[model samples]
Target: MPGNLKDRRGAGRHPAEALTCFCRDVLTSLGVPDEDAAVVADSLVRANLEGKDSHGISRLPIYAKRIRECRISARPDICIDRDGAVLKVDGGNGLGQVVSYKALQAAFPVARETGIAAVAVRNSNHFGAASYYCQMACREGMALIATTNSPPGIAPWGGKRAYLGTNPVAFGFPTRREPPVIVDMSSSIVARGKIILAAAEGREIPQDWAIDEEGLPTTDAEAALRGAVLPLGGPKGYALAVAVEMLSGVLSGAAFGPHVNNLYKDGDPPANVGHSFILIDVEHLMPLEEYYARLERFIREMKSHPKARGTEEILYPGERSYRTYMNRLREGVTLNPSLKSMLNDIGRACGVNL
Candidate 1:
């Protein structure tokens, strides 16, 4: 919690499974099939477990609304078009988690055979986090590079108006002796969902996160939503965002930049957002055991290096998220009052008791 959100928030904890069930029930009631709803629910809950609350259960209400408004299809006939190591997925305007998960699953066998495979998805709604898909690849002893484009929320470097998404890029690699290495980040300084969450909780954002409509930095979350999110590393981030747009949007033949509909605000027409995934089978390159040993050695040497002032032990990219997931699994996920209330309302509307 930040700013006034700390005072206004409620303290409530629930088992992750229970929350998942609640989410599934709501989606199913909205005409989504049981399996599809489960995939979507699990993705959201996993985000919470991984300490990425911005991509977590807070999105349920909006998802339900979109489904109800026919902006997102409840029962989609996802189709695939494959060409050797390349695959194209048409989500049929379905829930992103369900659509993207299917695309990744379809890529795995191709990657295993070809050593490398790529999947491009179009007509998908907002999927939770890129880490989820990358982690899936890691579990199969593969490395993955994933990226997705969203509605315009970030400006190009040196520009004042938004023309690019807070596009996210993620990487994941398997390790035998430790948690998989994962690096997931948005091109913007922070995700747009963080500002939305802050606004929902009546909190203020950090000034550097975004600019107001007048192009001045602001700490107000609402103003940030109305304006644009700043790029993560100025020109560097803008460059990355452009690359992501090319791969996920242009190459996939999906709506790019301002053409992509806003998932949270817009209802008319579908959100033709796009995503791209590249999978490499690590074992295909070298002996799996030998590669693991080398990776472990690298990790050990890095950790053995001197620490910065006041810093504790060095941790790998995904270590913190793995620890958080384990802790939350045991201790349960905490839900703020506002979020809890929204879920409750959704439950009532769906005739499900939470």
Candidate 2:
């Protein structure tokens, strides 16, 4: 857990299924197709299940507002241009989840045929989490490298102005019996969404997370929002963010750098976010069984290493999130008081009982 949210409390617990249904209903009421609504709802709820509450249902209000304002199309005329194993998809201002889902569906068969496939998406809104697409590809016995560019929030290597996004990237590798190895992370020191949540909760942010408008460190969430988030490892994260922008934005023919519209604040223009997906079929390189055995062997050896003091079991990249998902599935998803109120408000507006 991030230090900012460690002290937060929940209002109550609710079934993940129920939250999904409510989100789906709210989206459908706003003219989104039932199937598309379900896809976005499931993606958001799964984030919550995996303990990524920052990208979970907390984002629905902005989505709803955007939908009502005609910024995000209810039914996008998504078009795909294919060239060999590469695909370029134009989202037509559609919801990011729906557009990305369609793109992934298109990539699956191509990967199977060519052993590898690349999909570049443009004119999309904010997709919930990159891991959702990684997990989707992993489920089909494929390794995936996925990335998405968001509205600019992070500064360049030596600049104080916000120019690059906290571009998120995810990698997923399948295992025979163990949970898939999933690594999802942002280029910033912390995700900008976490700061947004802190601001919403009226909490002070860690000084390292972001800076004030004058490029000085501050604990005020609002001030941080007005400034820029720090890169994860300074220049290293800035370089990664540049790479992600190239793949997801420049390569996809979408808005990049500061050109991307903000999802929460910019209401006039559509947020033409971009995403890139690379899928590799395991059997293409070697037999599936052989790959699984090699991967599991590596994992076993790595986990068996001696632990430092106060260290418990050493788990793989996705092990912790996988455990959280399982536990939350059984115990129910918890919502903070503000999130609960927000959802309830959306429910009332959409005529759906939460």
Candidate 3:
């Protein structure tokens, strides 16, 4: 975060396709198989297009660092154990996106047969975005609830020290005549990745987002990174985060809370992050057309309601992100100069120019 690297011009747009190619090539150079590399690359670039910049290609540098350190196995021997409609997966300390993608694929047929299915994954690293998997489920005509435990970045309610992650939970519900409703959110007021991105961009955060080491609020991104992020709504968010830990970490038999290793700080130990997914096959529950009709009617009613002052229009959970994705796909994603510089540096290390 040196002053010289900060670009005052804000950000510059870049083609998503080019970024995906660069990300895939870099991972492949690090010994990741081409197919898996492409999966990770597509997920990262999709985040950028969806306006989730915190989980975008800006993360490739850290992933590359972990791969080189041997903390993340480039060719992990992922193992899956199934019991009826339930699945238990061991990721073998692999990239999270790859592990999660495989887990979802394994759940598809089981859910179709049983009406619902659950997949618990362990020994995974940072997954770019929870919504990515949720969207995949939607494409399979399923409703999915997905959650993941991350390295600690938040404290328990009324506590001063970091003890819980800003664990994210996502829900994807398919609808007729509308984009899938995807509600993807962190238990914290904001995701910790945003603070990391802000620090890398030499920008200050909103004071309410996180606290300093002394448990006081701070606008400094660096200080926030050193401390704990604030939960979404005090006790409620704290409880939600704990629930996510139980579902993703405890149930999956993976690292929970403080046990998860820091993605950047702990280079030697593999981050034993965990993820859980619940998939419900719409056709099995009710006729797909009937379910879609009900959902569309509900959305129409919700959107027709009167809006509060300053509100332009009501939007569904994933509507804005879907719009952003379309616009960015047609145009391009805007990358801050610092991010570009970091990506270029990673490219240089991998002997691939961005």
Candidate 4:
């Protein structure tokens, strides 16, 4: 771990404040228009606030390169056209945050009318954690599923050459007034971003997370980057990853496989990333209060169940992150020394100290 691991000082920031800083400094440095930068930055910082470090500020450098290289548009007047409950959004190569946010924002009203709405986006870059948007929909009493695809970072089942991005999927559901149940995960054994972070920190990666260049598993981050990551559960994970690729990348007509430039290598233009978001109004199934009450009961049972002999406690996804978020609220967000330096560089380029 970085020296700051024990120091909660830079653990996390307030959702709103971190959003502003990331937008103003990081995106602005990437040359995005002020307004567009704000949109992109807000979502990224919100990911951090939710304790998703892999999808947070650590992604800024790669996003900036995309912007500076014209792979991502700094100013996109996105076109969101609706076909009944479906929305097709042309992102104009804008930051994924701006495009995805606008698409979901528009989907909200459409879902209200039809009890469900879905949006597909094309020509956009990475949009941070998918749960951030799902959580947004959950706040409105909607069950949401979000997915995004990137350039190929993993090999398909029974295949060698990398042909898929990690391809994350998120599902968010709200029951009554309790905290929403949010599950966000990548189909790959681990996020490529997390591997990059591990490499940067000179930390050893887990062997199962990736394979070496020789097609063997390795615990070395450098070797993993040179190789491919495994699927979550063999064929099942591969199937899910392929599904995401089709829905997000193929449906949106974005790039796929190795043809897409690697975000860390920082060469070549962005592959015109794509994403899809779905929102379902719980009111259509049943009243929100009734659904939530039942959900709360389920949660109570699951959380209060007897513990295994070796296990201390059982936790649903997003539980640990919530604790970190609460603690980090009192302590400032922590940054690795190296990351702090990079942020300073962006600040200097943008002529702002934030």
TM-score of 4: 0.91
Residue 43 C-alpha lDDT in model 3: 99
TM-score of each: 0.96, 0.96, 0.96, 0.91
Stretches > 4 Å off in candidate 1: 1-11
In candidate 1, how many Å is residue 236 off?
A: 0.8
Model 4 residue 302 distance off true place after TM-score fit, in angstroms = 1.3
Q: How many clashes (backbone N, Cα, C below 3 Å) per candidate?
A: 0, 0, 0, 8
Q: Candidates ranked by lDDT, best first? A: 3, 2, 1, 4
Each candidate's root-mean-square deviation in Å? 4.2, 4.2, 4.3, 3.7
Q: In model 2, how many backbone clashes occur?
A: 0
Of 1 and 4, the candidate ranking higher by TM-score: 1
Candidate 3 regions exceeding 4 Å error are: 1-11, 266-268
Model 2 Cα lDDT, one tens digit per residue, 20-134 = 9999999999999999999999999999999999999999999998999999998999999899999999999999999999999999999999999999999999999888988
| Residue clash pairs of candidate 3 | none
- Model 2, position 16, has a per-residue lDDT of 85
Q: What pairs collide in candidate 1?
A: none
Cα deviation at 309, candidate 1, in Å, is 1.8
